[model samples]
Target: MTIADSPARYGALSRFFHWAIAALLVWQFGGICSEAILGEDHPLAARLSANHTQVGTILFVLIVCRVVWAILNRGRRPDHGPGLLGYAARLGHFSLYALMLAVPTAALLRAWGNERAFAPFGFPIFAPRSPDQVVQTATAIGSNFHGEMAWIMGVLILGHVAMAILHQVAWRDGTLKRMT
Candidate 1:
């Protein structure tokens, strides 16, 4: 089918970004959980934490591209719904985008403040900077904020999934078909 025929569904680029981000998020969350379960001093814990940082950095870059794609492809409509439902869907999407942006943005700031090196595949986000008192302070504050925001994102995601299931099972709507 031509692109126009599937306007309610995501385009090729959008779908790629969506799945890619989803995979990366899973990796990130898994790493976080692993690190928490294992002690910080454990070698496996260190490895998982490092993987989380690297994957988070990749997610940041992918999210930037996705935002640009979303803006450029803004004309494609979402599947139809009641007016209020449609508006709520849009708002939910915007909140997802915001969290996607905020999480990594905070991580980046934490990296900078803590003089932490983000070497993903030998590429660095910034040149290693000298340790600063402010870095520790900022890192503490930013890390707390990041953790809280992550919980918020988790709740929103659960809500989104529940609504999609409701649409599929209760209403027999095709809302989940677009993303899946």
Candidate 2:
């Protein structure tokens, strides 16, 4: 498969990024759902929670790369098309990207300002902040909005999937084909 995007379809790299990120998101949400349903003390929830931060860090890195790649391929990528639907599509994608970045970033900021060290995959990214030295503003922002923003993002993602299915089955448009 080609590595760069073209007018008709997404290239291999783009598809890789898309699917990989999608899978990671599924994992992330699965963990959240398990914890919510089974309670935090459940074995499945414990298993998933063990790696949540590390997985989130990896996801954040992948997102940054994906955004950079999208920018690089902007002109070469498939067109969004004309009219109201297209505008809505563009706006929707923008919102997704923004939340994708914001969610992890807020988490990271919280970690940074936390009393304990911030390490993902056993690698330290931020050292511990003493109780007195903690950045309360960063901590508060992250604590206050991370979960709320994530739920909003979850809703948007469901809508995104619904729209994709609609385009494929009802509209009979090649929109799904462009990515798949």
In terms of TM-score, the best-performing candidate is 2
- What TM-score fits each model? 0.82, 0.97
- Tens digits of per-residue lDDT, candidate 1, 87-107, equal 898889899999999988887
RMSD of 1: 2.8
Cα lDDT tens digits for candidate 2, 1-180: 799999889998999888899999989999998999999999999898778888898899999999999999998998888999989999999999999999999998899888989977778899998899999999999999888898899999999999999999999989898888
Collision count for each candidate, in order: 0, 0
- The clash number for model 1 is 0
Model 1 TM-score, all chains together: 0.82
